[model samples]
Target: MTRDGRRGEAADDPVDDATLALLLEVAGTPKPGNVDRRRDLDDLRFEAFLGGAVGARPGLERAARAADPGAPSVGDAFVRAVEGMAARAGTNTQFGCLLLLVPLVRAAADPDRELSPDALDAVCRATSVDDAVAFYRAFEAVDVAVDDPPPGADDLDVRRGSDAEPALRERRATLRDVLALSVDPTDPDRVADRNAAEWTEGFPRTFRAAEWILTDEGPLADRAARAFLGLLAAEPDTLVASTLGAEAAREASERAAALLGVDSEGPGGVGDVDAIPTDAVHGADLDTAESLAERFISEGINPGTTADLTCAALFVALRRGAEVAP
Candidate 1:
């Protein structure tokens, strides 16, 4: 029970945390080069995205329920939810977010509500080969852009879409196994996005983002915006790096850090530096962030990985009993 003696969760409604966070994420303005209340991509509209998120609520809830101890494997929930969402949205709106949130929702909805690192890892580790197949099926349902497959991995080609499912079965690869192979440890030249890395490392960044959201103040959207910038500033967006290049992604992160007047090193690094002007974003002015957003959109630079992290943070916040802003 919450302090108000009501059942504690993201909301009282039947809708689950994944759907709610997705809705809130798309609705957040000044999100920088992503579709939000303030802007929309030429091919996608804000309302369409909102409708898609709401439409996927049932599947997200089911996925959460499926994650309960002794219940069915939870990975299929992601595939079903994404399939349902693709049908509704007609595009790749929330695939990455879905990937991050399904496990979180499962952990949150546990009978004990034991939302912890260990619990989340357990949920991820429990995934089966069926979950891996479902994940590829979800990929087939959308046109999500990603880096090219490393050489010598013909069956792992994501572009193969559903065709890759058969190969997955032959290898008996689970969702975790797929992620492990996504980023080759031997290749120093290759880079994996935080999302993919999370699957292998047990989602440290998502949990850390959630922890930041819990301690953050201000409206949820503002907190989300800040978190988004922080994530980008700290790490180059893998989606951007893959679709564009490593240098482009690094520049995007540097620009975000400059806008927020923070650095990858630590908080308030820019402000504390004597060289940067006092008028710099020491206070993290909202207008400066918006300005950076406009520049990013114009430059065709989208920090999608950062946005995914924000949604993960929002899910963590809502799940941990932080009151949502009206």
Candidate 2:
């Protein structure tokens, strides 16, 4: 169903689904340290996200036109989307979300393919050095919160933006190749880049959480908030790690896991939201989640990478026919 409760009206339109996903992600309240309908960070307003979603549509349209002749490549679409999103929001609002969405949108554009991890993987793998250059240009559009590159990879640092273009060309790196660098942590104390991991590892968390959202009954916004919590609890947020260190990121995840009444230990490791029974996340859990949201906001511990994953999951859920009725 569409946002207005119309079934199948825009079901075939990946651009519409992707745009709605962005709006719905931010609309989910108590998302904990992220912008939502009921809360705002000091630097980012709820309205800014709305503007970013609107601005991203043209690029999404480009992605959805992938089967057509002269269509933009995945990285080109991503760069255009990031540029438009930043222009409208006056800052970087959905850079990470666009990073995930563009490939999924491109994959969904193919008439012969269904949107899945394998399809997304193929789309990512097909990118070229030109795509890598376009991706680096996206970094110059706005300030994205990413960790510094590992030792001796300074020429490939994302913050170098277009300046890294020559190096990327010299190395003949594809967009996937650039993303591969951040997929895993170099040290025991560091947290892996969750967004990059999704890109290189076929979006395991996004697909898993999308299934969670689709199967659960309730308003989509509430389901999104729950999925947000689940993804955050499952792993430490990469953005949190970049800004607040690995320990602080783990602490945030543990706190979320505790709110869901799950043991933060054992085989799945700490804060596995999947371990908690589905029905257990109600009433008291939500109340505690609200409190946690407030605390995370006050402390400036935003789990932004988790939010980005939730947005990608929402896109998948929408494409899979998750109802958007209020």
Candidate 3:
């Protein structure tokens, strides 16, 4: 529950380090525009894998239900698509793949509009290979940028061995393992690595990225929601007046806060708020997270709960296989 990384400027703004890695890789590959090139949204069958997981996210299933069977909302389409990815990969995952297909999901939901290219740009601007090389070069220009912590900086979060140099070697080892070949099969952090790898070959972006973004995060009732948002907010049309509105993400955020006995914004009729359990420390997978999520949805969703429902559904789809970090 400790805050991770720096403040993100905004949800659905641009790709963070994670998504950017996927995007830049896609852009460079033989199939940069493949997701876009697909003629129709439903024609893409990745939805079957998503199944109930998509239905579990906040707003996703309701949007699909509201839209008529052959038709689904952007949120609905995205969650289902991620479900499909998980099912196909033959593994458990939260389906963060939903993020990559955001443009496609929004486009499918909106018969009136095509998801814009800006979403892709948001990812590309951060990486794009050419930029990465420049970034590394820039880092080289700075002096005293040693991989190891200096004398007084031992208090830094970085782990060190007998001394700093050995620690740098260990750091490199971690990166290497995180970036290792697919013979072990589970790891693939950067984009360039996926293409060259033996096992991750020919898989959709959903499966490729979901390992870290969704599954590896560990399971806690809260994470299912985070995974869903990570994927849904990627949709081209998902960016709204504000991500902090009374939507699924906000509701999920509130639920997480309340569980921790923190402040939550809602009507005066406050219901029973469950205390965070000791086991929840192990995270979502260890908890009956999906069921708790369903309870959260039932209590919070009213007639006008379309947005919230869809968001939660998306969350379920993305985080299904993920776990909370220990």
**Candidate 1 or 2, higher TM-score?**
2
TM-score, each model?
Answer: 0.87, 0.94, 0.23
Candidate 3 has its poorest 10 consecutive residues by lDDT at 28-37
Model 3 lDDT per residue over 1-326, tens place: 21222233332222122222222221211111011111112222223323323332332332323226554433333444344434443342223333233332332233333223342232223222222222122222221111222333342212221133343344442211221221122222111222112112222223322332343343332332332222222211111212223244344444444443334434211211122232332232313333443454344321111122222232223223222235
lDDT of 1 by residue, 1-326 (tens): 75223374436322466667887788766877788888988887888777778666766776667435565456677877778788888887887888887787777777664667787788778788888877777777888878776666678776787789888889888888777766553555444656877776767767666666666677777667766766666667777877778778877877777776655453312211222332232245667778888888888888887788788878877766666654
Better of 2 and 3 by TM-score: 2
Record all residue pairs in model 2 with backbone atoms less than 3 Å apart, i.e. clashing: none
CA deviation > 4 Å runs, candidate 2: 1-9, 266-284
Number of the candidate with higher TM-score, 1 or 3 = 1
Where is the poorest 10-residue window by lDDT in model 2? Answer: 266-275
Q: What number of backbone clashes does candidate 3 have, counting pairs of residues 3 or more apart or in separate chains?
A: 42
- Whole-structure CA lDDT of model 1: 0.70
lDDT of candidates 1 onward, in order: 0.70, 0.85, 0.28
TM-score of 3: 0.23
- Candidate 2 residue 163 Cα shift, in angstroms, is 0.7
**Candidate order, TM-score descending:** 2, 1, 3
Best by lDDT: 2
How many Å off is the CA of 308 in candidate 2? 0.5
